[model samples]
Target: MTTEKLFPVNGVELCAETFGDPGDPAVLLIHGGTASMLWWDAAFCAKLAGYGRYVIRYDQRDTGRSTTYPVGEPPYAMSDLATDAVGLLDALGVERAHVVAQSMSGGIGLIIGVDHAPRVASLTFVSTSPGGDDLPPPAGGLPHISTPDWGDPTAVEEYVVRSIEAESAGVFDEEAARALVRADMARAANYEAVMTNHYSMNFDEPKGGSFGELTMPVLVVHGDQDPYFPPAHAEALQDAVPDGRLVLIKGAGHGIPEPLWDEFLAALAEHTESS
Candidate 1:
């Protein structure tokens, strides 16, 4: 896998990494809130690469080795995030790509599908809520988040790992969890910048027109036991997109399970190839 590097886009730089040959089909992976692209396991990316897919996973503006501004709230809107994705594709000279994202990134994917339809091939949403008021609110709602000391970067990092461990519970692999935490924390630019982006951005509204307009294949994968967004959220997404389908994993939570990685990868491969 290629290491993370800064790509200039929209007057800022986004940190991104790549795998597989450039000649293959493209799959762009977007991570969740406060999470770097590291959340998408390297082994999973390698699996896609082996399948003749050119996979690209990248950090959002504030979360990883990308641009960060600690002094104030983020000036960019959710649309800007969507623009960043398309911009990244442009930077790579990719005309179109399959967008695969998790959690908040899923909402962003929907935006891209709606506003920049020509640039997207297909969409895969994992453990995420649907955009817009057409569907009922997500089941179980969003889980309550505990704030850590924003001034102390170490505390912020610890909180991130601890929170993931708590939510993951039974399905989590200790070694893998630690490795991801190390990758994310080591590369995080600033906790204040993360907080700024998190609080300032609007996640509920569908700023990129209607998801119904996306005629391409859409896939929603969610865990039956997801604390943040329940299975019904996946159902909502499926309902919203005419060509969308849902996959409800058993015994999994908000995070993907290590043992079930094969199942997740298999489904993703099938969906990608179908598009």
Candidate 2:
């Protein structure tokens, strides 16, 4: 694997990791809210690379090793976040690639597919909901991952560790879990511009109408037990996209990359390869 430093939109520097041959078809993996690229397990990325894909995973702004908030400007909108993805691809000289995203990142991916259609070859949405008034909020008081407060170092560290543990309780490998928390802490220590991005930018419109303009293939993967975005949301995505297909993973939850690693990899490989 190789790591590349890229400057996407808004002059934000993004830390991107790549696997497989650069000459192969590319698959961009966009993580969920408050999640770093670490959310996409290394084993899963390797598996996708094994399927002859050039897999790329990057930290969105304010999440990992990426640029954060500006000094005076307000938080960025979801459209800006989507534009960031496009800018990253442009910076990396990637004309078009497959996109796989989860949760909030899924909404961003939908925007990319709609607004930047030529740049997206295929889309794989995992454990994501169509945002808007129709989509219900998460049951608990889960902080929106996109707008974290990195002001208090100690508190941020503790929050990162606890959040990772709580979310990946029984699913993640113990060492992997520890490493993820540590990575988050390290990133938070250096970056404190978390709250500069708007969480409600895309919440205004349902993800339905956007898909009407997307011509690329789409695959919706959701866990039957997904707490945040239940199976119904996946069904809604399927209903919206004329060519989209939904796959329900048994006994899996919102964290697909953790519990449903193999299944997720298989689905992605099959979907990205087929016509």
Candidate 3:
């Protein structure tokens, strides 16, 4: 069973759900921009819990049931988001956690690893780049392009389906995506904030440390067919870290494809256990 609660962190309320025993090692699942904890499915969390990990997934500010700002007016910077993660750990009384982050959150993971190294046991970056001018840009342009009518839930669902279809190359369940999106729209405090605020947030670069300074075990997992950040980005990320490894999901895309869940979970279990 999973327990849901609201936490006061970084002067904002963040809705977080936890699976498995608190006595076990903790895994913090951080979603990408414009996403909530729903992106990290309950079943997936359960599987990680089954691996003897206490898994925590939360809604970032401006997403899900967490705090929100007016459309296009996010009061915090990207670095603030990273600090939020650390604040959440402090609130939870967890001194250290294995951080698994996807897409934009991967950058957040890097910041946390560099700035708050003592709070993290390991780092898992999925479907995101380490950000350098030399890295190859996302294939076929950037993602999250199709805008839908915010008032129309059906339009929003269809838009999500279309976005997934474009971003993925492996097995995708359209109905499942729709069901999740439906819940997301229904539960969101402000659906417009979910769609627009993240894109406009100021991104203050991390201070004092670089990726090469990360001493913890870092795992870079990327879909071979990921359009947003290609395989080369994963390679570059892996190469940047002193102790890093890469896992390429075959025929996968920017998101974690259901068909590759087993492989992803196994990699995660091993990485966290060894770390």
For candidate 3, the TM-score is 0.95
lDDT, each prediction: 0.78, 0.72, 0.88
Candidate 2 lDDT by residue in tens digits, 1-275: 33656565556678788889877888999988767777776778888899999888888867777766553343666767777888878877788989887887787888888878888889988888765568665547554543345666656655555565445424546666667767665664244444234353334332445766778999999877666766788888888776888989887767664656778788889887732
lDDT of 2: 0.72
For model 3, residues 144-230, the per-residue Cα lDDT tens digits are: 656888888778778877887778864678888888888888779888889889889987766857789998999999999998788
Candidate 1 minimal-lDDT segment of 10 residues: 134-143
The estimated TM-scores of all candidates read 0.89, 0.82, 0.95
Which stretches of model 2 miss by more than 4 angstroms?
8-10, 70-74, 132-155, 165-175, 189-192, 195-209
TM-score of 1: 0.89
RMSD to native for every prediction? 2.7, 3.8, 1.8
Clashes of 3: 0
Q: Relative to the unseen true structure, what is the C-alpha lDDT of residue 138 in candidate 1, on a scale of 0 to 100?
A: 41
lDDT of 1: 0.78
Best-fitting candidate, measured by lDDT? 3
